[model samples]
Target chain A: MKRLPVNRLSSRTSSAIIWIVLLTLPLWMRAVGSYTELGTQVVVLALAAMALNFLLGFTGTLSFGHAAYFGLGAYGAAMTIKYLVPSTPLAILVGMAAGTIAAMIIGALIVKLRGVYFAMVTIAFGQVFYFITFRWNTVTGGDDGLSGWHRIPLNLGFTTIDIEHDGKAFYYFVLLCFALSVGVMAFLLRSPFGRTLLAIRENERRARFLGIPIERHLWLSFVISCLFASVAGALYALLNNFTDPRALYWGQSGNFVIMAVLGGMRSFWGPLIGAAIFVVLQDYVSSHTENWMSFVGLFFVLVVLFFPRGVLGIIRRRTMR
Target chain B: MTQLILFNVFNGLIVGAFYALMALGLSLILNLSGVINFAHGGFLAIGGYLAYALIPFVGFWGALLIAPFLTAFLGLIVERLLIRRVYGRDPLYSLLLTFGLAYIFEDSTRFIWGAQSVPFQVPDWLMQPLSSDYFFLTGYRLFMVLLVGAAVAGLFLILTRSRLGIRIRAGTLDLETVSVLGVNVRILRTLNFGLGIYLAGLAGVLAAGMLGLSPTIGTSLIMPSFVAIIVGGLGSLPGTLLGGLLIGVASGITTVFAPSATEAIIYVMMGLVLLIRPRGLLGEEGRVQ
Candidate 1:
């Protein structure tokens, strides 16, 4: 494999600088109390986008229905709090478990189809989930969604924290999770398995000939990506304090794909960039015009036509030069 | 029970014709350009809307003639500018790109025509009953059945007999070789795309009268059209026809029995088919990957 000559230290230092700058901006906003709620929502969306990036950017598998897992997580958390347990920790765990299981089941069937088939199957499964949520009014509340679901209070043996009462505290908790997930993802990408996944993406036939179990690798990547997505979903539920079937809708899934692609599917932090751009655009556009969806659609067309590689791709090109 | 079954079967075939039209275009584009064309439904929506728009001024026949050609021209531009660039790249790029285009088209339609369902009335002349007996059917539906059958026959004749069809078949068979042999493969591809869109437009015009026009109608139709293409073999016209009829009948019967599970029935059938024969009923083996 040909290696590009790039300085490790400078990159690490710059990443740290970027992290510090990003982390402080939220704190700065909170201090000023300007658009703090919107800031938290952006952070949550960024986490979901980053999770999608794991498969889309790193593994080169485009999933049009990742929101299935996202919705699963949200519902799992919401249901857990509603029915059995009200502990925040327990709800989060339930969300993660639900998402992982759903991913594994759907991944097994869908991972068999390559490229377009795979994308289509995932989309169908997402639709199935959406339909189930919509029709099963007893559980999911159908279209109206589950409301009045109280937030779980965080209970550590030493300290009990009520996240609902403190928006700043909840924001920090989400930020911490985002940081941890991104860290783990970065580590995985640097590992041997990550390199192998890239190899598979670049040339699946070659990878298969080299004795790599391509199907198993893809299945594993799909499950892992869904797990990350579910965690984001759980956080989103916490932030919104409600869960709905809309979380699993095809449009929501498209939003995730748009974010990942817009920010730069090839870049490590492209989804984060993409999520920020998407959420901000939605915020701005919806406020200005009733036909905001058309504008968003226009953005998608422009991105596809002009920037095939995404925002991160453009950045990499400039930096490489 | 016999009367009910016959009625459902007739209804199924009517719907099936529309599905066949949409799936045929999708399958052709997939075979020739290696694109599944997520925007195919968008073009279908355009056709439906165009027909609706034309109903006030030019009547149904005139709208049917003008709308599909307009959509075909739009498809030509899409192929020339957007789809052509990504032919040799990863298939996912085209999928994502087309998906974006679908979003844009759907949203643009919503913006132009409000989100409310638009009314499209079948012409009074075509609204008469075909037979006054117990086995009742409308003239418009009979007209649709004949129109689709004629369209299919016309498509078949062109593909089998026409000079352009020969070039298209040649390009589909071996693109690089055909290009080497001095045929402009790109032009054939664009023409194929135009033809596909034309079919979608025609289907849309028929559907707008049968099923009301809504901006989101295309989104709902796209998945079923995909199922039809996959179940039929990708790029096989006869296979698409068979797939479309099968799905339409299946859905129609399910709707009669369990209306709530109507959507799931198609996907369940797809899963079952995949399990039994991954290449689909008429799909050529090893072409699917």
Candidate 2:
């Protein structure tokens, strides 16, 4: 199928290069005057963006409130660790489950809406979780944020890695998770179901006429993307050893969409690249000026006006020439 | 208890009026242009700040009348300059552009006015309670309701009676046909956008008085406006008006009983509306035009 522009061989070669570059990122990050935490953040946020891309770039739907599920994952993991069990794997699973369940419920309500209406409703619905986290203060820590919880070290049967202290170890762990998630995403994108989503994106009327169950498929795509976003959120909570209502805020959802768009929504790995630039720029800007928000907003304006096609899109077009 | 219920309901109506005003603008743009205008709240904050600045010179009533006009002027500029560029493109670009504008607007407001909440002055007589039995029925509140009522009535009149309003309604239903018939669509859209922003500005001025003047004011009120549009049925302005009031009263009542669920209650209504009437309470027969 001629879905993505790049052929199978180039895709393979790019993936190989990407894996090598990512594996060695921790080592070179310091040489480039960045920390391991930044790399880990890029990985986590990229995953969220990619998850969003599943629906946005592929399914042709706009959801401005995916952060709700992401926050749910974060809270689910943090709460699981702090209140239930301290196991990392179990916490991740719980976080994923919580996010998936929330997505299912919200997806059903929203599947019928399209375009801007869908975007509006998703954003409005997103605030429900934010309010819950903000108001259910005693449990979720309200606006002050969920504090007192820390990411515990992972213990495996063969060996226990002290991820609590060693940032590099944690980075590698996050990279592994990123790999697994992206791998699943890529595999699915090549599947018949994935093609159906792409078909929907390309032409909804045609896809509908092909006997595709529109709302049901949309719900599935929404739930799936939320699951992925929630996993990223889970990773985010672990990254800070903290969780907050801000994680689920509508702005965060906007960030994910921007990342996906900034990376080139049509390209599978585009959001990762977008997340990297965004994280680095945000880090540098905030450290330098108090009016960093203006700069960030300006960045959005510039990107939309001049670079709507994104970095990867530019690259692909150039290479095509 | 009845008095308390009455107080909350009235307060909710006032709040709902604000949402309806904001939603009406949002819906106006969405119906005609297909852009979500995420920066609308930003326009609102600007209106409040403009009124705040003008109050020294214009007085309370003058500021109320002038601030929204100034905001509409700014909206005209924004529509002419920034928003016009993104119009024939994917809906995503417009959404993002406005989203960015929102960020810029909020940050600039904070930068200029300071992040702290400034007290908005209402004339002393207007603040007085109208009667002992319904002490909560303050004159200022009644005036706000009347002002909002007038604005809604005026909007309806324009849409039905005026040439520009008829053009907008016609453009909304069939822009191509209207354009082919020799209407200046670009001008129509710009005016329509200004009209929407004018409502936003008015809401901003009133919201400043009631909610306290703050940089965060725009962000806080925006979501409910979106909810109002959704619940009211996407294309229909009257539906948006009803949706805004319904959610407002619902949230208000919830505040009286389960105060924490006040915001949550509106979203619950949205969910129920979507399930029961997917097109919304007054939503048109199909997906958004």
Best by TM-score: 2
Instruction: Indicate the DockQ of the complex predicted as candidate 1.
Output: 0.50
What docking tier does model 2 reach? medium
lDDT of 2 by residue, B1-289 (tens): 9999999999999999999999999999989999999999999999999999999997999999999999999999989988998888888889889988999999999999999999899999999999999999999999999999999999999999999999999998899999999999999999999999999999999999989998879989999999999999989999999999998889989999998888888999989998899888988897552
TM-scores across all candidates?
A: 0.93, 0.98
- Checking candidate 2 for backbone clashes, the offending pairs are B232-B239
Q: Can you list each candidate's DockQ?
A: 0.50, 0.75
User: Which residue pairs in candidate 1 collide?
Assistant: none
Q: How well is candidate 2 docked (DockQ)?
A: 0.75
Model 2 residue A160 distance off true place after TM-score fit, in angstroms: 0.6
